[model samples]
Target: MTLGEKICRLRKARGLSQGDLADTLGVSRQSVSKWETDSSVPDLDKLVALSRRFGVTLDELVCGEGDAEKEHEPEPLPAAQPQGRQVLGGVLLAVGLLGLLLFTLLWGLEGLLLGLMFLLPFLLCGVLCLKVRRRLGLWCAWAVYLPQQVYWTMATGITWRLVLTTPHFTREMNYFRLFIGWVMLAALVALTVATARSFSGLRKEPTPKMVGVTAVLWAAALLIWRLRALFFGLFADETGLIQLPGLVTGLLQGACAAGQTAALAAAITLTLALLRGRQKQTPG
Candidate 1:
C-alpha cells in the first residue's frame, strides 16, 4: 500500500475519523482528509506520530511491512468477564440484595422500601459490575432509570404518600392507573429480558427485536404518562386541586424514563452497526 493508503487504513482500524486524527496530530482536519485521500503526504514528524499512535513500527508504517507476530495472532475471545471479576460482581450484588432484604425486615416489610434509597449508588455499582458482559448501551439505560427511581423513592418515603388508593377515585382514574401500571410493568419486563439476553451464554447482545419492543413499550409508557398530566394533571393539593410542582416533577420523571430507553436503543444500534463483537482490543 502507498504511504497515504497505510495511514488511511490504520486510522480506520483505530476508529479515528479525519477530524479525530487531525486533533491528535495538531493539524487541520483537512490535512488528515488529504492524507487519507492520498492528496497529500504527512511529514516525517507526522508519520512518526501516526506510527506511535497506531501501534505500528516505523518499518511497518513506512514500508508496508507486515508484522510477523500479528499475522498469526489469535482470534478475539468471547466478551466475558474474568472469573475473579465475576466473583467480585456476585459478591457486590449479594451484598446489595441482602442489604435491601435487611431493610425490608427492619422497615416492617412494607413501609421502608424507600428508606434504603441510600443504597442506590452502591447498587448501581454492583449492577455495573455484575452485568459487565452487557453491551455499553445498557448502562446508559441504567443511568436514565436510576435517578428518577431514587427521586421517586425518596419523595414517597419522605411524604409517606402512596400513589394509589385515592378517595376521589373515578372509573377513568382507575383505568388510567391501570394503564400506567401495566405499561411500566411491561416496559420493565422487556428491558429485563433484553438485559438477560445480553450475556454471552444466551447471546452476545440483545436482539433488535427486543430493542424495538423495549423502545415501543417505553414510548407508550411515556405517552400515557403525559396524557395523565394533560387530563388529570400530576400534582394534587389538600383539596385535590392541581399543583404545579407535582405536575412538573411527574412529567420530568416520565420524560427521563423515555429518554433512557431511547438512549439504550440508540447505543445498541451503534454497537450493532460495527462489524465485530465487543472484545478486548489486542495491541494491534
Candidate 2:
C-alpha cells in the first residue's frame, strides 16, 4: 500500500478518526485528511509523532514495507514450563498471613457476631472477584447465608434477655425476629441459585456506565439505611428494639439493602453484556 493508504488503514484499525489522530499528534484535522488522501505529507517531526501514535515504524508508515504485519503479531510463548503452581501457593500463603495479622490486630472485635456482619460480605466480594466462573459468586453468596443462620443461633442470648425482661411478649417477638432472619436466608439462597447457572455469564469487564450506576445505587441504599436508622431511632422503646413497627421496618430495610447490593452487581454484569454486544457489532 502507498503511504496515504497505510496511514488510513492503521488509523481505522486503531479506531481513531482523522480528528482524533490529529488531536493526539497536535496537528490539524485537515493535515491528517491530507496525509490520508495523498494531497500532502507530514514533516519529519510530525511523521515521527504519527509513527509513535499509530505504533508503526517510519519505514512501515512511509516506505510501506517495514513489516507492520509482523510487528502486530502476538509475542512467542516461553519454551520452559511456567511456575504456575508455585506462584499460586505463594499468593495463598500471603493471604493467610494477612488474615492472621488482621485477626490479631482486631482483638476487641473477636466473638462479635456483628463482626462477621462486616467481614462476610467483603470476603464474599473478594472471592467473587478472583474467580471467573459463576460458581464463585454462588459459593460466596451461600457462605454469607451462614451468617444469617447463625444470627438466630446466637439469638438464644437475646431470647433469654427478652424472656426475663418481658415474659409475656418474649416468645412472640423472638419468633418474629427468627422468622425474619429465616426469610433473609431464604432470599440469599434463592438469588444464589438463580444466579449460579448464569454467574459465568456476568464476567467483570470495566465500563464507565456500569461502574457509575453501581456506585450510585450503593450510595443511595446506604443513605436510605442511615436515614431510617437515625430518624427512626427516636421511636424505639426502652429495649431499643423499636417495638413491633420499628423491628419489622429494620428487618425489611436490611432485606432491601441486600437486594440492592445484589441488583447493583447484576446491573454491572448486564452493562458488560451490552458493551460486549456493541464490540461484536464493530467490524475489523
Every candidate's lDDT: 0.56, 0.56
lDDT of 1 by residue, 1-284 (tens): 67888788777665567866765665667888888788998888888988888887888888878783552343344323345556775776677678777777877644244434545545665666666543535663555455544454334321111233445556865555545444444555566556644532221223476566556655554464456446554366678786665534554554444454444544444344221223322244
RMSD in Å for model 2: 16.7
Candidate 2, poorest ten consecutive residues by summed lDDT = 155-164
Which residue segments of model 1 deviate by more than 4 Å? 1-65, 71-84, 133-145, 152-225, 231-284
How many Å off is the CA of 192 in candidate 1?
A: 23
| TM-score between candidate 1 and the true structure | 0.35
Per-residue alpha-carbon lDDT of model 2 for 87-107, expressed as tens digits?
A: 443564456445645765776
Best candidate per TM-score, number? 1
